[model samples]
Target: MTVDHVRSLSSGINQTGVRAYNERLLLSVLQRNGALPGGELARRTGLSPQTTSVILRKLEQDGLLHKGVPVKGKVGKPSVPFDIEADGLFSMGLKIGRRSADLLVLDLKGEVRMQLRETYDYPMPDTVFGFLERGYEDLMSALSIDMRSRMCGLGIAAPFELWNWHELVGAPPAEFAAWRDIDFSAEAARITDLPVHQVNDATAACRAEHVFGMGREYRDYVYFFIGAFIGGGIVLDHAVFEGNQKNAGAFGPLPVPDVQGKPAQLIDLASIRALEVRLEADGLDPRQLWQTPQDWSHLEAYVQPWLEQTADALAIASVASCAVIDFEAVVIDGAMPATCRARLVEMTRTRLSDQDLRGVIAPEIIEGRVGNNARGIGAAAGPIISQVLLNRSAALLGALLHKLGSERTSPFPGRTYPTGSVTGMPRAV
Candidate 1:
């Protein structure tokens, strides 16, 4: 069936109740893991083979999924896998950074359809919202996608402190004038008129990496994102664990010991700000240092010490975190290019090898494949995933309620009703 045809049919099922939930569950699984065979879907969802077949047929008929070519196996019958129709629905992702904002239009399968970057001289809250709304509108217009019913919600990822201002105030107490008091979600929602989901940039990167990158290899791992600031996300049991207030992975403020045994914050010692300061001290322009060969050579002279100290601090944090969370490995990510990621991974691995923490398995620190687009793309995927999950949960509950309602006997001790009875009480005993 054609993608548009399926979308139209599924649109009918949007408020059709219980059936919509089953479709959402199927779509959610596909969104998270790409294409998969019906049997695998059954395995993951704990639905019967017959039920899986029924749901798949309905989803395919509705145009939410399409059958891919059969893969020839060495032994048994070729399993026909199903994949999401990328054109079926699209969502927007906005990554708000200190220096720039990135916007991406993503499909249901989390593929980037279009991207735009805007750098800011100074990002005031109001101006940032204005730029974001304009960028979103421009992208939608460029794609020629109809805003009504076709567009999913917008997802945003910003710096941890900016995103979770309330939490920081209770703990470390940041002094950023602009971030001291703000309702980002309400402001953005008012401007865009689209439901906005906000997540920390590092947390969003972790979600992107976990869903689409090398993070699938291990269930429990830490995703370290190194950019202007150093931050990370924790993945436990293959799920991103957003703590009680949805602020779990703020790696910047985690404490580490200095040479004099004084407590130093991780961001203070390991961020790009530190790198820039070191370069300036060595009589090199930080911007030129990143661009020039001679400056890189001079920069590399300081890289070993910088990397060593950074790795040491990271190792300390890792050990402390593992003592509590017991993650299997730590995956490093961020705006760093492939080569830089490799270097950081190597440095972290070497530092881990030298540490003597008895009876604790040292996590294998590795590079993530998602790169700089991790936060942006992941932010885009958020609303799509959330909508799918919410729809599924509501559907499942409706189905359970239907089944319970059909069963005449009340499970409660005080209630019994006659056949075709209007009152919920027993008729004249």
Candidate 2:
């Protein structure tokens, strides 16, 4: 489908777009299952063999698919497997994090090719826009002209009304206020020649998880992302449900008691910023926490209290979340190490066991596979989903995939908690 048709179809699908839909269906099959012969694709997609052949030819001609090694069949002509052209399309992701800005480029298979990030005390309009300008230029210079032209669109992930949290992050009100009047996505589109999409930072992270991480298995789950602040997103019926106001997973504002037994939002107790506050009081540099997961090794003393409170808050939130939605799992990830994530999951489960879960089918707490990279990766997927999958009438195909789930090995396997494996979360049944 042309870009114009893709844009129009994103609003809603219709009978007229069935061809585009079939194309996306076949592509998605190849994406999830690696490679398969045309007849196999036809059977898997329930499309007529002739229709599958026609679509395969067109996709090959369009440079989106290619024939792999021929395999000797039991009888008749040898079958040739077709696979996706990873370089067929590309999307850019921009994450306007509270403390930093990250620009990333992802190919068709969702692999990062180029990334740029910079940290600042607080974001200002000029500074953010300038970073986008330079980052875009650097990315383009590194790509061949042909590859650059194949760019699909750009997706920006940031907390909405970020200026409202200036006090929490210790930023000057005026400097942060500049964000209130600025449309970062519009500015990004102006800086680049690609169409732009925007979503809440946490939601973007959840999107990444849905598309590239656990969504490959579980279709219904509650997501919690620990950044400078704790944020959340929900995936129901195989898609991220943003709710009426686009804040379905805004778990930060949930009421929780602080250390002093005073009421406070969950964010105040469960965020990395809370840990940072404690570290600062102990005369330690807080920047070390954001550098990488490994830097948090010696922080057991400071992180322990936050962990106890965070586990309690998460347990309460998860129980309440399950009472309303029959989620299959609760995914937790953040700017911390795998061990740290495992410990949090371990504690949350312990706390959850103590809660009065009557009338609620409690969800299993699972560590997110995406971790700190979710927002950037998920932000990168927004435009791809909008311009590719949703734009085509491929909602049927998406539903089918959701039912079938990942047939191949998972990206992070055998690391689920309770079992004490550090590799990844357990596969959801």
Q: For candidate 1, give the lDDT of residue 428.
A: 15
Tens-digit lDDT track for model 1 on 100-182?
Answer: 67888887666788888776433457667778767756675565434224466778988765634433222233434566476
Tens digit per residue, CA lDDT, model 2, 1-429: 333333332222121223465687677667656789998887666667898999899988866789999999799999999998877777889888877788999887778998988787666778877898888777866776556656777888889678899898788887778888887767886677567888899988888887778766776899999988999898876667776666669889988777687888889889988888999998998877777435667889988888888998898889888988889899999878788888999999999999998999989898888777789888888766665453211244344445545463333464211211111111221
Residue 130, candidate 1: how far off, in angstroms? 2.6
lDDT of each: 0.68, 0.76
The lDDT, on a scale of 0 to 1, for candidate 2 is 0.76
RMSD of each: 9.5, 9.5
